[model samples]
Target: MSPRKVSLMSRILVYVLVAIAALYLLLCVALFVFQRALIYFPQPSAYATPDNVLTLPVADANLQVSVRPHDGPKALLYFGGNAEDVSQNLPSFSAAFPDQAIYLLHYRGFGGSSGSPSEEAIARDALDLFDRVYAEHPQVAVVGRSLGTGVAIRLASQRPAARLILVTPYNSLLELGIRQYPMFPVKWLLKDTFDSAKYAAHISVPTLLIAAEHDEVIPRSSTVRLYGQFIQGVASMKVIAGVGHNSISESPEYLKLIGAGL
Candidate 1:
């Protein structure tokens, strides 16, 4: 090859490399800047009636907790998914477990709650709610779905929740994020690790993990891995057939299984 052709080729190669490097840096910066937005999908509460709304001060934020107050020892505390409007499920929950009082938390920045949402903030809020509810209701069962599973697991491990139920659980947000963004350094970029697997090992109460047979959002393997982390005989997994991650709740047997677990 001529010397001029070799020089041109070298310059083109350098330009290509630089362009790729610049794109990568831009991606990293975007991930860092909007990480929280990627993790949390906050929305207003679906149920605004005075009968259902209860406010609790969580740190600096006044968290709105949806309550179905019943005078009894048995209570159910629920933490919902990222984009979920937990208040929408009130009717189903009330019908499913009419005997037990139910409390569903709207995470920070979600459902009209103040401040931003993070794994640490959500976990702290969950523990605070658990402690407060436990004071009144001795037999409190904790239920969590998707992102809330992390909060629930951590709370159950640290507190004395009578029964624990996880729906469409994952091993960890870090692991799932890594799988979703294999090309990037997800482990380093992800701020909300939500390592439920780490907390699962410490949970002492009877735990039931509800897994979707064809979960697309959270892989079935991830839920199974989380179930394995629990101490022997402490946790059991039940898979619902013909459902995906979000659709698991639509199944007729969804609430039935939860009632049975509790």
Candidate 2:
């Protein structure tokens, strides 16, 4: 209870608090740098255009794209996984709809495309890609899977897509970012967390939302919220049973639903 004894206790408490603060700072740093690891993503691979390949250049950017056009009248413009080199899906796409022209968007960073991957840049590219594709084929659909759902929703809100498909979707990356890094200032610190639900209801296209019951990355709650929010617009939803996020697209029953959508 004496002054000297109180001083010793205060000093020890100060040292302990300082150590704790330093550790928390390190955690915040980890949250920012390793945030991508918390989410599942696949890197891209080279795409060989054996059929017919054409290069389309976007204005004010270094990302001129090469698209392998299918021999058909109706076409599809697709945004793929954040980490995915979407060109790798071309063979599966060819098999799925051999008659429809497919434009697999090479995202800014993925598929050797130029620029960095930010939410705004991807959304802008989505709109630009849609505009370009729509000019060529007026009756075209937009397909987005995983991270691309944000891109798809943004594009649909701005333009008219014949059909809009979202696979393993989320409501907002901002929400997820905060959840993963509560100690850090996620809202201010995060460079991009595309929130698709905010703009879903405004889209009037024939929308389709597909999610698995056991989605591990983006929760089913967010996907359902997005679907429910689309009540103002024309929308339909399909849930694949006994499947997780990544495997849902590969499910036979899920593909049957896709066949119906096409």
Best by TM-score: 1
Residue-level lDDT of model 1, residues 179-229, one tens digit each, is 988999988888899999889889989999999898999988888889889
Best by lDDT: 1
lDDT of 2 by residue, 1-262 (tens): 9999999999999999999999988887887787656553545547745453345566655553446575445777778777767776677776777767888877765555666667787778778877877777777888888888888888888897888888888888888778666767898666677888888878887888898988887887888888887865588888999999777777887656655666
> Which regions of candidate 1 fall more than 4 Å away from where they truly are?
none
- Model 1: weakest 10-residue lDDT segment is 39-48
Error of 1 at 139 (Å): 1.1
Against the hidden reference, what TM-scores do the models get?
Answer: 0.97, 0.87
